[model samples]
Target: MTNWLLRASAAGLYFFSAFSFAADDSHEQFKQAERIAWSGNYEAFQQAVAGLDHPLKPYVEMAFYKRHPRLRYETEIDHFLTIYEHTPLEWPVRDSWLSYLKRHNKKARFINYYRDTSDAELKCTYLTYQLDLGALKKPILEQVADLWTVGKSQPKACDRLFSMWSKAGYRTPELVWQRVTNAAQRGQTSLLDYLAKLLPKKEAYLAELYQEVRRDPSSAAGLYRFKQRSAKESEIAVYGVRRLIWRDPELALKAWQKMQAMFTFSKQQKDSVAYRFALALASKGHEEARFWLNKVPHERQDAKLLQWLMSNMLKEQDWEGIAVLFTGRDNLSHGQKYWLAYSYAKRGELDKANTLWREVAVERDYYGFLAAARVGVPIALNSEPLQVPQTLLNKVSQAPGFKRAKALYELERYTDARREWNYLTNTSSDDEKLAASVLAAELDWYDSTIFTLAQIGAWDYVDLRFPMAFKDLFIRYSERNRVDLAWSIAIARRESSFAPDARSSADAYGLMQLLPSTAAYVNNRNKVSKKRLFQPATNIRLGTNYLEYLKRKNEGNEILATASYNAGYHRIKRWLPDEAMPAELWIELIPYTETRDYVKNVMAYRQVYHTKLGRDGNILAAVLDMKIAK
Candidate 1:
């Protein structure tokens, strides 16, 4: 009996194992079928689906059919309609479906579905469809009534509906005005009377609205009312006088003095009025602006006015006054601190400048470099060798604006750099590959650039930008012009980092940072439209032409021309009369440190690019032969 029971148990275990294996096989088949469907192998996917039985068959079929192309108009329309009917659509996809439906002339169908559906999004979509169909006025009126009915039960939806109604040009409705009055009572006045027209019968609402306006005169609606009234009216005159007190204090005093007999006020009100009186006196060059500002209650003091006072102090180089403002509760932003540091540096307070620089450098914020550079301090973190943080390096590599290959090179991760360079050189234009080749040569890696360039057939992408497009163009241009290609590369790198859309603070645009006026002149001379100057080929053409023009103007002095390109030709020409100096010395002696540093950095970068091209030594020889000073 025991042997028979054991046999029975073993038999059951075997059966269970077999069933589990079969289930596993089915799951694997489903996964493979899904893969096939995703790859658009419809025939294989359909066969896989057919092989599935019962419940799995429907599931697999649905998955496969969801991806099927809707070639026929009926199929496309029916597919979306069915999906919309059955599924709760997400915002992004629902928006797409709505657009598709509208484009296909199914607006009525969409509106019907939207109204019947209980979903908030659906109702919103319906209202939008109604608006789009130019049947907004009726629906907007209905929505206002719905808001009153529902009250706070669906405030968000009501708000959205009200905003839509306002946007659709129904803001002047009596119902809307009533709703605005209600909203204002509840302190939700932001939307009230926004673009609302004033009704002729204003006496009923004016007193309440005026009180709210007095509480916050900065409100646009209040300002509009004050402007609309005649100057002789006491209330209008008082409101306008108060506005002018802050904005144009001198005018406010004149208006207030003229209306002295119009009204009586309490002692507190009279004292509260003293602040503006002092401001007006100060505006007329009286020292009382400071006197009143000091006497004003701390709680009542205007932060904006204080900030303005600090700004004026800074403009006057009042270091002690700036320090006083800095010590206030409102700590300055990094940018503000940087400005302060600049002021300190100009005052010859190196210790203070260094302290500010240290604070900025440690933050590793976007403005750190600019701040540190302004203070003549090298941006360092904890006395450590400046290494790009791995997180930052990874982020920069993935950034669309930065060239990954160049960024990798900068990070000194050479193997990965070579891989990216290989990819860019292999798949892009000849000029680009040539540039890659130059980079490879600098790393002592040969043939990769040539092979990649050839593989990509880089010449097909070339236009007037020539060398700017390809590494080979640089070599050719350099040889033809008898100038160092390395130097040109350096300048280009500093100007744009090779981004075609690079723009400067001075309104210089494109890869070479050409000023709009300069670009316009170049475009006109070339008979190219002003708009075309932003295009890569056009910008490069004009940029190089301008560069060449500057080179010639500076008597073939590359350094001087490069400086003139950055700091303006007129400024450089005016400064050149001091003495004929080597380019390096001239760069070092440049009055504007920005231009001076620009020349040095460009020269240094030229050598770096040359080294990357495996022509570093050769380029150095060529640069030396020019006998260029400084």
Candidate 2:
């Protein structure tokens, strides 16, 4: 590696106490060769590293081929790519080779080697090559149509192919109108204007008006303009009303009532409007929700709508409504089952409720654990170990792809490292994938390990799936904060899968995913400080303190505290029931899907962590004893 790569890699490795590179002359030689490689002296770069045997030698080859414009040495480049096929090393060489083939008009080989990609230019090139070779077919034309009809402008390379496709009558005014609508939906007003010019005068007018409706959905409230009530005009009305409902449900409802008189909406269009209006009313607790929800036909009641209906009923304390909503549904999630059981129990039907609870208690999850507590049975983890022998693990770990991935990760080329890791997980054998997950866990790449296992549905390997990452720090901070150690650890695990430098889109950092502002507040409040929020120790300490604060803020109710931790405490306060309600019912009624799922996963993971740490594992029993109240 070059000095920059070496220094960067060293800095990354410094974070892990268990990892260290050997201080040897071979390292110096590699660095010297890498410097030459980057300096554009390919011959000297090769000579410098000729005698070396290193895990990162492929990187030097990659540097050369990536910069080499021509594919003069195809065999050598092919060998390198084949050896590092799924590794990050394949990226530059493959791209270079593909570019060379396109430039040279190597149509057959380009088509042969071409994998599907999202790059419009590359796709255009590929299709143009196919057109040149007389491989035109319906599917090919369909692909060309798809490419041309996208909302945004395609690359200049696509112009020739699009012109040919248009000459062949594949480009219709209908497709242009579709593109106009697509552009409007994507907020590409310029593209919409460009597309509208391709349509007839009347169609262009409709297209422009649709764009106007997109810009301001309430513009459709001028029902006089839609007196034509054409299918296209009705489509614009339906589209406008659906969006308007979310912004102002009462007005949308009034407009929708008027629209039914002016427009002839198809069954699908009416159902779409009803779906949107019903969900909007139910979500906003509008007085008209029950009416709108009932307007939706039974066959049109999808899972999401049913869930919202149940939630609306629960908020109204209509247990009979909830019971009715779940009737005839064959597939109920454990959470759904728990709520259904609660509904039945509230309606004085203990037999049906217990039966459903027993069914749910047989599984493992937040609902399963809580149902188990209700039914007086042991929560079933069904924890089964993946039976990969050490020999298989050793063999798979020795693969060159895994080595390159590890090397890239250690060098802190996170994007490239993730690409290589994802390739392995996606393409490997069942045994190999499981073994690689085990290796990933051993390498302390907990995020990759956790997700890889999930990708392969390998939930049975609880030990590998849930490693005790940063346990010492967790214990220290949890004790200091007087929080449950397992709960704290579980929170970290759910937040980031123990990735010490994890960051969320919300700008929460480190294993515990604390916002920097929150971390600073906790630091100032505690008279302690850490400049780096990404550091595992500082994040854990601050996160545990925040958890303790949430617990206290919620009056020592862990369930509410957990919910408050995911959602804000103020939101949790608003979500609290007016009268005391069962914990299951309250959790079911949490409006935000993210916080609802977050609370459930944290609770379930905490229970598992308790058993893993040899601590008391009855967190759910205490949770069941508690009630949610104002």
Candidate 3:
């Protein structure tokens, strides 16, 4: 056995298998050792994993620690955690090891091993450990109060800590009111009631009023009762008004008008109310939207407010309004610059518009493409390939974390693989991240490649950012559905980044992110099962066919079809203008920010894919040629 181990070690074999010494066979043995560890056979688990030099050896050791969990293995646990500090292996083992130390009353070791955590029990124990060591400082007491003042009841382990903090006068009436407000906001009624008892008899009534206003924001109409104009009173009124605005904007406006007359609201408070009220009014298409929006100074208008105002202006063809909104603003985003240039052109300031368009066209985004088309400039890809040193690339690829990530990916444990990959990228330097993206691309893990580049803001690496994945599938489906090939590929890329196993929180599945219902609706003649929806061919085919259906339904307009694909056809009908508009104008007026951005990205990505596919496509020609009818 010793001689055999020597030969296997010399040959770089990770595990010995009876069947064969292939990589797959070694993986199987590693898996088998994990199962044996779970079965509580420590000696057999050890022997099974013996001579293993694979990247997954740490995982096997973690499994053994779970089953054994003896303090005698502390040295090995420390070594595992130190070697795998940023990887997923560190947390579970460290958590369990801390628990073991806590249970054994090993306070010194616990303090040594403890890292900052949000776990209330661990935090309480950590503070208690400090208190036992004569740490009654204001900072320690303050941390104890932070844990104590939360809305919900903490674990029983916090009881002793709370007693100490209260004795130290850290739990004052002011802190009690703060907790009361938190509990009320979080709808922890019982906790709020308990906290109210901690206040003086006169101020306790404020807690009852808070509960009343929380339960029925309409109670804010009785503004006369709040005569003190205290900070707490203002908080209650603002909370009620904010909640009320979402329910009934007009009523919220009336209540705020009355509250402002009675209370001394600061400028920030007034602006906060104005911002929410403006958004609510604009979203509901209230006539008073413009009035409320103007109440907010231009400096305070964020992207959402700007988008809403721009949508309204585009609908009204108020080019001067759009121009005025962006004029003299040096900090405009690319989209804002495009709109500003369009406004200038519409209002006959051709020189200014052309100059701005020239600047905007240099970018590689939706607005950049549109600006380029407007000014008749060549659309720039701005491709700067990520160039990493061969030595660094080789070193990164051979890192233990990268090796384990690749191994997990090869074993089809994608979730685990993605976790490991994310950890690797998050902790790597910029060059290391670029190199990691190259490694991910080589492994055909396009999602990680795209996300890592995005994380490092390496947008000029267009090839890495927009990989040509599943080219044949996209082409075949595009032809089958009579859809534009680049368009279909762009949609899939935007939806899933070509991760076939992608599933969204909305239960959207696979490469195209099709909700099962939509897939069934499109393929009513032959239902594609949920399982097949994840397959690249089926997802592309179904998604493209659905896009085609939307196109034909929208009078063969691809822009409308793309919008309907994201925001539903029913919403598209509601959003349609009574008068005909340019397709770009109509697209800008889309109410849902998500749908609007989706359309813009899809259009831009389609153009990028077109160039990537070696086609002589003009990005501007596509946008300028389209029009939407009433």
Candidate 4:
């Protein structure tokens, strides 16, 4: 027999021969190998893992040593690579090996094994490696040019490579201009300033001209400041027109009329500027915006233009206008097609509505459920349970990358931890992917656990899908405020995905995603003392009280209460109509993309939670029963 089989057989026999161990079998013994490895029992781990006939053997071996900070030698990592070349552990081990070499200044060793063609940081390291060997010239300069042309600043690891390029006089005016143009399109003013300093004194005037247009588009509204015209001037005119429209669309229209008579802009530039103004005004629900939008040739119209045009029509209840927007479009999304059908229904065209609804009702989602309700069809989840192999489960449980992922989560570096967890899922077998998902849940990686299962198409595990994390707190606060317990669970699932430590860039915190100001008001009203708003019990209490207040304001419509919870109550009130309309249509027409989707997702989660809790009847039926408050 080969060496590997001998080791496997030896491992299988070790437990039986060694002692009267507490575990039942080899699988159970291998489970403890991971704990022993993390407990800093490297030698003991090796001994135990050797007596284990499981796929976790190699993973447990590498995981213990990867977390230790003192193992810096190149030869030591090289030994690891040799043993695990073709195994499932190769990528993580190799990635960490490269990181160790880079962090410790082992340049020669990094170059020897480095071939990461995709990561820009490692590519800069490649240039540094070539510079060290004195084999630099044309190729190195080409890479420097590529890196410097990006619209945003390159990562700081490129500092050395960029300095070398500057010393060699390869940084040219042409390359700087490209980067400036890219930065201008992206509104990256800081990057534009940095690139401007690299320009020659004569060409530096161009950057100042671009800045003037950016700062105040009204100055060039009539194009009366210039005696001459060039391509640069034409581009500046386009930008100025867009800015003028943003500040005052009515005045922008007047300026556009005068500029057309006074200046000659290329057809492409004129179309570009007109579309920008039209789309902006349409977003704000300007009455005359579509008159300008219709002037753009049908061939030039795109998805964004169509969406904003539809939004304006929906706000006006001009069903014919909505139909006209999609008449010639061939690339309509499922959502768009569903909305088109709804428009036809409002126009009393039942045949067309039925045809469209039939196509959309087969999938599972907010729209699909609504479509199903409209056409009297059952919602189709079409999800299947995953069958994981026992061996792959062992690999997932003991991989070094997973250990790193868990450690990062503990530190509250959620983004970094997500990337590490991704390494564990990237190439895992289907069953192993499910096992990784369970591992995430076990670690209370709420978002990762939920999203990972969705990632792998394993959607039937409702318990995993709708986790009962912090149920006691949800029940306590929800009942105290008379908020439906299911609504509280639904809000938490959508807001933070049951992550107690979740936070948004807006400083919204915890299970309910309450902003500090909102949390403070809730606390003051309840006479509770100030504490961490992200703490589970406190956040739930504040959030539920906020929900109760909204429900009272909206006449007990959970749909409007939920929408108010995401968007402020005042905004939801402003969105209310003079006449009653179906609540689903009201949600579909809401302008803010984030708030619209927030309402849809939370309501959908409400359905899932209700179904999982053994409630019967159509969930969307109750949601649609809501009427717009007059």
lDDT, candidates in the order shown: 0.50, 0.80, 0.82, 0.73
Model 3, clash count? 0
Rank by TM-score (best first): 3, 2, 4, 1
lDDT of 4 by residue, 472-531 (tens): 898899899999888889999999888777788898888788888887676774443333
Whose TM-score is higher: candidate 1's or candidate 2's? 2
RMSD of 1: 18.4
Best by lDDT: 3
RMSD of 4: 7.9
Task: Score residue 142 of candidate 3 by CA lDDT.
Answer: 81
Better of 1 and 3 by lDDT: 3
RMSD of each: 18.4, 6.2, 6.2, 7.9
Clash pairs, model 2 backbone:
none
Prediction-by-prediction clash tally? 17, 0, 0, 1
Candidates 2 and 3 compared by lDDT, better number: 3
State the number of backbone clashes in model 1: 17
**What would the per-residue lDDT of candidate 3 be over residues 103-208, giving only the tens digit for each residue?**
9998888887788888999888888888887775677888877897788888887999899889878888878987888888887878877877898877787887
